[model samples]
Target chain A: MTSTTLTPSFDEQYVATRKVATVGRVEISDVTKSYGANTVLRDVSLTIEPGQVVALIGPSGSGKSTLLRAINHLETVDRGSITVDGRYIGYERKGDTLHELREAEILRRRTQVGLVFQNFNLFPHLTAIENIIEAPVAHKRLTRDDARALAEGLLARVGLADKADHYPRQLSGGQQQRVAIARALALSPKVLLFDEPTSALDPELVGEVLDVIRGLARDGTTLVIVTHEIGFAREVADRIVFLDHGEIVEQGTPGQVLRNARHRRTRDFLAKVL
Target chain B: MSRIVAPRSETTAHAAGAATPATDADATTDDTTSASSATADAVAKSGPAGGRLDAGLRVVPVKHWGRWVLSAIVAFVILQFLWSLATNPQWQWDVFAEYFFAPSVINGLWLTLGLTVVAGVAGFVLGAVLAVFRLSKSPLLGAAAWWYIWFFRSVPLVVQILVWYNLGYLYPTLGLGTPFTTDFWIVEFPTTTLISAFAAAAIGLSLHQAAYSAEIIRAGILSVDQGQLEAAGALGLPRSIRFFRITLPQAARAIVPNAFNEIIGLVKGTSVVFIVALPELFYTVQVIYNRNQRVIPLLLVAVVWYALITTVLSIAQYYVERRYARGSVRELPPTPVQRARRWGAEQWNRLGDAHTAAAPPPPAQPEPVVTAAAAASDQYRTGGAA
Candidate 1:
């Protein structure tokens, strides 16, 4: 008759840790996305651990980038569900019925998922510090002083403390990318998504940006990077996923996947890449 | 065998000089290498020729000859028309001076300017409000704004003035003298006795100007980037602050130029108020022409004044636009000459101050020195430098 008999002994401890880690884990279940007759992602299912750095790699039109965008609800999925920190994003389920989340709700959820685009879409008019503190002050209702302090700290962390007052147009591509990363981190997001953060950068500048991202991975931040930098993936990523034609053809540790791929498509991809 | 042996000897000699070999294996290698090198050289040269040909075909510099010819034709036509007008025997200078230079017409110019200023200010404020209302999300407000714009725009200025001037006929008492009305609540019957022609003209002109100003304001607002609004929203700026601070400040650059044009239009449109006998420049000219019958000269006076006023307005508009454009442009700093003059003035002022501070000792002498320095400074301060 006692509730102690019904519950597990470590329920309290488990609940507390679960609540803490719930801030970071992103789960995608049977997620499928399509544009009219063309499907981008088909029945893609993946679970990213709280601090795991996942690299999504594939040839062009392979749906790797689409899956990353779907996780943030930038693109609506045709089927299935994506959940971040146990909260349903883009779609809500109620008593066996599912409905797409409203725009306001999606915006609220997007605050928790930070996306860094390849183009470094920093508001050109605002200074780097202004861009970094924009969301915190506006969306989170943080005081200007607090937001400024946090933004300054993040800018320093990204090695752009001196460039905080500079406009996006004045900074070099690498510096802009770093500022963008700082801007994303200012929100204290649960997950950071990088959409080829260095693909648009000059070859000489690419290494510096990749270094910042690698440093982020080391700090145990949950990251989903869609990238062409296979070397970075091999070195920093906890799990490397190879996608092909809207399907996850193979996924494993970088060594098992990059060097000893079992699937023929993965083998062919590695063969060409190596 | 004899024929093959002679060719092989020639090939072997060619290979031996290159220090490879003179064997049959070398012979086949030499043949393949010679053929492939010749093919590659031909292809490389041919590829560039095609590219060069395409480049040559694509190179078409713009020609200004057609524009030059069109401009010359237009100039000739304008000159011919002006020549006819100048040579006409019917050009009456005396008649022009009698009506155009009349004192009444001068007063009309002042009246015209005053009316335009009043109407333009009222219309612009009303128009801005209507534009904001039209852009609002509430259906009722949007519909009301649209309806107001439509109604005002559809009616002619002359008709509006006539209706307002004659409003006394519609409501004899001006609805102010009901028996039950308290002294505070009572409305006076000013429509019949107090409604002047100037009042009617202002009301009519302001209503018409408001409609056009609304369109200009709406276009300016729409020209702003959506990202700016989003950025402001993200900053958590309140709705009103976001609009006035972020959105309107940016839109000012676009809005100012058009608003200037509308002001000039309002000034010219004031001439239409002559129908209501508001005694504006054109109406004053009409009065002179009525007495003297100097039709052409009187009309010319009004035309000249309008041109002069418009020219001044245009210059003012240019400076205002330049000021607003500083938001985007990186202006050059003042020249060294300007800086030097500024420094000289400052030094002179300091000297004057020192002299004044030593006052009672040599008051008269320092006064003269200060005057001399000021005169010198005044000479250098030409072109409104200050």
Candidate 2:
């Protein structure tokens, strides 16, 4: 791989005509969530710098996906707050307190953080290009024509230019995931959250989706991915956070967590998967 | 060696041909004879080492004599039924034809169609609103919708119609005013004037249809995968767009067939309005039959009309189903006309090939070609102006 400068200014030099500079400083503060009796997150707090990639890995029922969902307000926290670029998600700061925003306002903030689900969740009724076009046009950020052109470019970026008109059911699992990646990028979200993006894919197809995510990691966007692909996580993520039983068990550089975990639970968990 | 091989091959072919009973089989006598000749030619061309195993063997299929006999009996029974219809004078074919398109009957038919259209459209719209209400997060709204469906569905349509017709007895005058008080009336009308037989029928039918439609719509909405709505939300689509663009289109796949079924039922259900004397198709026929004492023929006219209306609705349902199947199905089922056309073309090809037994069969539909992958960059970038 070429030694592309890992700087915020790199996008301006390469794809200057396409996008503006991305600002995705994520601040997660003492966030906790629960569903009835099950506590999904317990006082979870993490801050990711702009353009940094963080991979969340844990066993099932861990708070990884819940935490990722909270960033985009897909899952609301029972306590604490999440903000991207210093603006609160799902709420507006009023003096000393946080007030819950209206649905429209929350939705507005949500556009800044795009989510990709494990199942790909591509709209079956829409073609690949149309799926990408739907959000930008609905948000009134671009005209239909502009959205189409943008969609075409995104599809090409994911290597699915010819599959622009294919429905989700018509494409293979790998192609659908790529389209999903393109869809998440369509809004040029400041932050992208991927929840088990490659878990649903066949082994051979995992590389294609990982390749798309790898490309995004280098392009200066804050990404929080919940995945079991530890090798890819190690290569792409600037930091790794491991969770267990609804709490962060360990966090550090991949080498620290994977190679020399400070906690017994983290090491035991890593031993089973590795 | 050629002479010796040809004699043995011919004997085997002859024996195989004689083994089974003669029937309409895939390999006919002409094909068998051609196969023998081809085998002989191959033997002559390549000497003793030429012929493949299983060459020149005509395999006969088992004949289903029982199926043949059963089909003959069914055809005779069907013919008998048709013959009775044609020969029976009690059918009053002449009277049936005369009254079928009479102006009065046609006017009644128009009224029936008008009632169905009005009630169906109103029913579905109200039902959609009720369905949304029931599916809403607020318990108050959900219960209100639930009770509405429950009350309306429990009441018989005929009883509801009667209640509506005699609404004047329950309330002499209806008015818009302060809750539970008439003193602050903004507008008023006599219940008798507002609730005529036609109005009563429309209200009763629409309310009844709406209850069922609500359930159908609700079921359809619920049938859509939850992930679809989450995906739409993640895109930051507005609530209206989420419901209309994402949820409704997918739900329509489940809703269309049942909705159409209700509409067709409404068409037939309009006959119940005859009791109120609002002269729809069935009511008009009843009146005509009572006056002329030609009940059977007039009744037949109504039956045929109802059947015709149902046939049209069924066809529309098929097309509507095909429309919603767009993204889900790989290929849309052919329309009736397309199916007929294809069948005709097939028969034409069969006729052309009847004399040429040696011709190869036409090929099946070709598979869609998958394009080769051109490796995209491993590095992903956001869309321009995303």
Candidate 3:
């Protein structure tokens, strides 16, 4: 399932040409989000460096998915700010105040950060390849022909070359998730986020999707994955952040947070999951 | 009885790929007696003949006496009504045929179709704009759209038509100028000259239809999965692209059937435009009948034309719905023509078998394998079975 045909080309493109191509540094500072009285993210702060893959692992209500979505500005934060490559996603700083950018401006910036949903959420009406090419073409980032080629390349990279014309419903959960990964890659986003990519998949199908993500990590693309796959996190992630009760409890290399967690809450959480 | 049992058992035994149980009785009866070897196999398996009938058990079809009685009554009523129509001279079948395709009547038919098309398109366009406005975040826009829908839907259509026709009474001239002032009229035209009977009818029908179309389009947009919008937004697609490419296509699956329903209603709704003196089909029929004193036949002509128009629309709706059904339904339901073609092929194959008298049984179809594709297809089937 892990064919490395297209990764070499992507690696060269990211590592060679563009200045911020390989370095999609994500900065999240004091980000707090709340829904009425229910606080979901409590001043959560984390930084992911160039080419780094960070896995956010926690319980259901631990705000892991919210943090990932907020990175892409999918969820608005009540306090603090998030930036990729030192540029705000949903806002622009003017003088002393942070002014929220207009919808068009925000959409322009959102192209740099792509989010994959837990449900795979591939557009049902479009075929897999069309779904991949739609955003890039619509945003004018690529010509239709170029977008199609990129889409085909991405599809091959994810091991679904023959499924270009197949609809989402025609694909297995694993195949659909793989196509979602290809779709996110088609935008050539500087930062790619996965909000529990494999959570909705069948147990046996999880491996195929994870294998594709592992290939992405090796291609020098910055990735932030919210996942329950602890073993997968250990194998691919450069940093693993353990969150509990809407706060980051422990942050370190997988060996530290997983093997010798300092906090008792982290230890208890690990004890249950392990 | 022995002969009948022997062939029946052979056919039932060799009826490959048929569903089991209740419906099997009818299906087995239709099966050709071309599998005599299979009959011998059944006899060999049945131990011994009891009373020169060792083929298979008798299968009595489950009977519905109520259905029989109801169908008989319905058929008798339909036949009697048709008999009366043929026997009665008041129908004026000759006069009906004469004007049914006459030049003047045909022109009226064209006018009806033209009005329906123009008003339908204009209504949907305005409705789509209003639906977007209603769904927008600005309260002012939403309230304005709401008010427009309310006003248009509240007034009776005929009254609206008359009001539009008599718009000159309210405003002698329509002009583009500063609000609340006629000092510097940029461009002006007399209301009567601009609002002809046909124009008034078009405006009235479109406005009346727009209110319903707005609700239909809005409900259609709302019917789309929230996740679809999120996915489009996450892709960084522009709002226009999001609406046209992502939301509208999915929403179309919900919108089309209801939209066509409204359009079909509008086709008949155009009949009421006779008040404005527009020469549409129903109005032309009224005019001809008033002059010739042949009311029933002329009315029948108009009825036949309306039925024809609606039939064409219904057929078009089916195809349009099938087109929009891509990726939503697991397999497109077979079209009627496709069903007929398949049935004809089966009948032709049965005829071929009838000639041979000892044709070999059709080869058994392989059991369908439950692969990942099948499981995924089943998932979509259940999810979208609605």
Candidate 4:
């Protein structure tokens, strides 16, 4: 409430804004992951240029969400590397040795890559603005007033300025998801990932949440969205990657992929989903 | 109003059975007319009867003979006990009050309260550590906690104090020294000097209380959701922040009630220290009664003191529980002070309601001060703005 102005001071503390207008080039190379004998991801490789909005569309258990999590190193790849904006996440490579970074390094890198969960895991104990301001004050080196100012700006951006003091339970599922997105954006991460963000919401609530993501896409935030909303993906994403059975079956521009998917797995999956 | 009818409340069938004027043919005709008229209505409204059972079936009210008999029996027993207490000289009330505030007895009560505080604090601190150890990720640490609780909880507190008192026979001297050889690093104090009766009592009581407290704390920790821990991990908050901010606050709601139960028990349990000749309240009462040969009155004095302490502890536990129970409820239940105020406000409002109803409340009868508590729930908003 004290600092309502979105001054340059708050913007300067953001990692994304400080980057030289060139950020979030995510690289995934030869990535493989498994839980026990059941491999969840297999030899998945993709590249995203700065400000490119990519949509990963697939059925359950297809490793589409796993691929999104790998970009932030929330899940480590068994045999490959994921780098966002040319910096290795979770692991540091020195010549042939790829040693896992310490927890502090992982947390520091995590502050730069934001992940929004399907459940919208807003801390239940904190109010909406507190949730938004927590990471910025803790990790972004922003003062309390500046963090509050930045959080207010983010909340206003998400069309929730009036909900500053409301607890998470007091908000609807869609509203809570938007608050979660605001919280992720608080530190101004270079890359943003959304995992089935609308799947947990009711059909009526899905549009408001989708509108928030659409606004982010319009404003040119680097986004990797794993979603089942085909029309939304077609409208918002620059490129669409379709996966089935733990491998990327096809990928192209939205029209090219959505209209005429070449692979059988991609077509069959789209046939059911669409 | 009826041309041919029995009394208003009597069953039609009963009246018909008593009738000498109506023939079987007339009765059959009446039954046929009524049956066809409301056959569907009978099944729906009265389960195969067109009206209530009182209209067609014989019924009578039963007196509550059992209730009267039970009430009489309870009143008789209570009256007999009161009569004996009032008339008998053997149960000397005068003797009870004479030694109740005696200096020696007061000192014993003071010592008892001191022991309760010391043992309760030490027990809870050790118990908290053991609870954390029980839940530690390392299997060795968890097993060590489990074994300590198992051993201490199994042994009797009185026996433990006795063993500590006679420890000189076993250890002879207690000090920091290298094991298996006599390479003493510090001065060795004699066992008798180290563990006096008071020390033995405190140690035994604290150890016994600790084992029970550990389980209460462990259960509280386990009650917090696993999702909260995962959420903290994903947020990249360090382990310390996660525990202090996320886990322990939530666990406290579950832990407080059980902890108070242990503390209240410890206050009463301190009387057992007398086994090691540490003269707490129970031993003090015994010593005086044995001299004067007025056992019942001296015992009554101990009971009264213990009851008073129990009442204070119980009140403290209530407020502590309320404090921790915040945020779990929508509006915290009114505190005892607020409740009393609200009750007073409600009585005044009821007088206003009676005045408006144009009927003065009876001056002779007892006023309804003890109405249902929910009636006062709306007025509870006065003091909880903070």
Predicted complexes: DockQ each: 0.08, 0.65, 0.66, 0.21
lDDT of 3 at B153: 89
lDDT of 2 at B151: 99
The candidate with the higher DockQ, 1 or 3, is 3
Q: What is the TM-score of each candidate against the true structure?
A: 0.58, 0.83, 0.83, 0.73
Model 4 chain B weakest 10-residue run by lDDT: B1-10
- Quote the positional error of residue B241 for candidate 4 in Å: 1.1
- Scored against the true structure, residue B91 in model 2 reaches a CA lDDT of 88
Q: Which scores greater on DockQ, model 1 or model 4?
A: 4
Q: Clash pairs of candidate 4?
A: none
Report the C-alpha lDDT of model 2 over A218-258, residue by residue, as the tens digit: 67788899999998888778799999988888999988999
For B72-152, candidate 2 gives per-residue lDDT tens digits of 999999999999889999989999999999999999999899889988998999999999999999999999999999999
lDDT of each: 0.75, 0.85, 0.86, 0.79
lDDT-wise, the better of 2 and 4 is 2
For candidate 2 chain B, the 10 contiguous residues with the lowest summed lDDT are: B370-379
Cα lDDT over the full model 3:
0.86
Report the lDDT of model 4 for residue A86: 74
Q: What does candidate 3's lDDT look like per residue over A1-274, in tens digits?
A: 5544424354334335323335699999999999899899998999999788899999899999889988888899999889999999998988888988999889889988988899989898889999999998998888999999999988888999999999999999999999999898887888899999999999999988887887777777899999999988987788999998899999999989999999999998889988
In model 2, which runs have C-alpha deviations exceeding 4 angstroms? Answer: A1-22, B1-69, B343-386
lDDT at position B60, candidate 4: 54
Per-residue lDDT value at B335 in model 4:
81
lDDT of 4 by residue, B1-386 (tens): 23122222232343334433234323334544454324322323332223455334455556899999999999999999999988899889899879899998899999999999989899988998999999998999999999999999899888999999999999888888788866667779889999999999989988898899899988988998775665555566665666776677778889988888888788779999888877788899999988989999999999999999989988988887777665455456788899999999999999998886786546688456634443475457543332
| TM-score of the second chain in candidate 1 | 0.62
| Candidate with better TM-score, 1 vs 4 | 4
Better of 2 and 4 by TM-score: 2
